[model samples]
Target: MDHDVVLAVDIGGTKISAGLVGADGQVHRQSEVATPATRPLLEEAMRGLLTSVADGASPRAIGLASAGPVDPPRGRVSPVNITAWRDFPLLDLVGAIMPGVPSVLVGDGIAAALGEHWLGAGRGVEAMLGIVVSTGVGGGLVLNGEAYAGPSGNAGHIGHVVADPAGPLCSCGATGCVEAYASGPSMVRWAQSQGWTGPDARALSADAARGDAVALAAFDRGAQALARGIAATAALCDLDRVVIGGGVSAAGEVLFAPLRKHLDGFLTLGYVRRLTVVPFELGRSAGLLGAARSALPTAQFESPTPA
Candidate 1:
């Protein structure tokens, strides 16, 4: 139980991924599989995923990052998208699968921030926020070189933050939340309401790239809301940098161009205006490495010694 390596797991609505990681920030023998709908199926898939990745290498500790809202105190999870796992005791399940090793759990947003800060886009920043702009908007704070999850492990959940009072309603039963404007579906929904025929965010991005006025306008609007949220976070956190990732962010300049412009308009204070926004450098590996790093301190490698 004295190895530098740890078991890292990233569980989401659509997929489950597992890997073995070390302090060097490398994830090896990673394996991924579609997430099943039922809890039993999920456990079965997870076991397979872990077994495939672990091979004969037993990690000392386990770090798990899952879609939330999660209760770290009780080691439970209730992800919105994963219906069968309401208040599921994730820690216990992981412990059962990989016994005799300590495990740590955190929201994926926080894990992403830690990952980006340790080795990705937020590297070397004193205070930062990692934003995932996908189906939903998620925010994670990395303040003073460490993650700040706050009480209830929900400090940086910025999706519900009011960015526009007159904006659309959010899934969290709030109006004008940033997620209602900048989330991929939200942007596409707005575009469709305006006669843009694209079915998803990807098509919208393509249309915007080709100079489709309505599509471009959709991105512009989404960027405008995202800018408001980012500026608000920067103002409050006095952040040195912000890193954006996820599917919608992959739209590249289609998203960042207007985002920068709108962000400039919202940034008032000089100190906050200095915050630099960038895309995540680690891509999909961010959460994995983040979980690995977070679990490293407690990692207790034993048994199944690398054969």
Candidate 2:
């Protein structure tokens, strides 16, 4: 059986990833490029990636996973962290780059959830959350067997949800956002503010593993902040499971154990007791695969056509 292929692009504040994906959820060919600060340079880089992957197979559609708040209806990006893009018409740009191809745009967090649902840990689940604890905290929801993109396409900006009303100021200019305390870089910054002097999240994690008091304290604070955020989401959405991903999540049990402990105390009843937190199954590929998965019908696959 022949399946239609799609060009899948995942754009974050720091990087841009592109791939040629068959309907079966496999990324047959891919490329990564530094995300340009400016829109034109970013678009050029994406065009180059698409052209490179188009060498062997013609794609019927384009699937994009971008940082929010993206105008899914218009396919434009309004990312808070990436300053150059303010309501940038991303969907139109990609459509123009590959004329006649149908395009679908989704938030990276939501895309991650869809990706996990199709090929990762969330498979067969009717309700779940995909959380990315990287440079910032972002999340997406799969509720009732569909990806939930709230009105305005900003449904999963869970990072902005206030976990500590008096916590550090966030890039969003808000106080107490989960990202302000729990993001990888934010954890490092918090540690520095505490006079720990760790250079990065990796070093901090290492020091914590060695039982460094300051490092452990910093990680504990981060874990608590993340737990607060997750608990809030679980309370509101009644999530059955959560899949945590991104660089910070690499801390493994160092992070999860504390998160679980904190969440347990925060929960009040049946919903709280049933929520399960797990590691993300696809690692870095979740965003790209999720973007590709968004292009297909949910929960099923079609074979790809021969090149």
Candidate 3:
């Protein structure tokens, strides 16, 4: 079978993105569809898009990057924010659609890390963390030169880690989760609660850029929460680099400047004092590229170890 190209699909809460990705990490053709909450409809939509992209090339394998908590071992997905794909057998479904080709499932953040590791910023790093700070916070880790998907495939769920005991409630039914205070929607909510009249995060960011006191405070709050989470992750894992991506990261220095300041205050040891946080290099394509990396031969790593 030709391994020159693979079918890569990135299924997020808001959209399902499919592409024919070549070995060079370039997507030759791509399509996107809005995600629906129902299982049957969502499945049908995914099938249609895949079929269209597949055409006659018949890719060697299929790679999927999905919003979790996904059971990668079994290729099953749990409840996600946008879709009603509870306990959905994703690998089985994709296999049925593609027939005999092997398919692999991974979390979106994991996929992003893989993409960055192969074709983006995490290229030469032995240890790195890829984070998506968009509508919600998500993360994937590459430890000791390999993706570290823990038991049950839920290992890189950095967003659910509690950063504040009394912060806002997260959609995951947890209070003070990092996502509750740092996600795009959460930032908008915080700004609104501060009596700033804004439609969403974009408007709030604009207001902050204009020196609106409440908007600036809201951004600071979110950045502080993110800094706390990053520091905890660095301390726990000894990560060498942190690559931040996604929609909210578009806030640029407005968000990152404060995050760096707060991260410095949180770290105590000199060993981890040099941890670097940088913007993700691949942008939106990171997930698809990372998904494709998952389908590459495991032999790429000489040691017989699970990643």
Model 3: CA > 4 A from native: 1-3, 298-307
lDDT of each: 0.84, 0.83, 0.84
lDDT by residue for model 1 (21-119), tens: 866787666888988999899989988887777767767788898877789989999876578999999999878888887899988888888999988
* Residues forming the 10-long window of minimal summed lDDT in candidate 2: 298-307
Worst 10 residues of 3 by lDDT: 298-307
Q: What pairs collide in candidate 3?
A: 115-290
Which tens-of-lDDT digit does each residue in 75-177 have in candidate 2? 7888776788898998788877788778889999999888898889999888888988887788899999888988877786788999989888998889999
Which tens-of-lDDT digit does each residue in 1-307 have in candidate 3?
A: 1245789999887678998876666788889898877888998998899999888776877889998889888889874465488888988889888898788899988998889888889999988889988777889999998999787776777888899989778998889998898888898998887788889888887888888999888889988988888888888899889998888888888888888989989988787888999998988889988998887662122223233
TM-score of each: 0.91, 0.92, 0.92
- Runs in model 2 lying further than 4 Å from the true structure: 1-3, 297-307
Better structure of 1 and 2 per TM-score: 2
lDDT at residue 253 of model 1 (Cα atoms): 95
Model 2 scores a TM of: 0.92
lDDT comparing candidate 1 with the true structure:
0.84
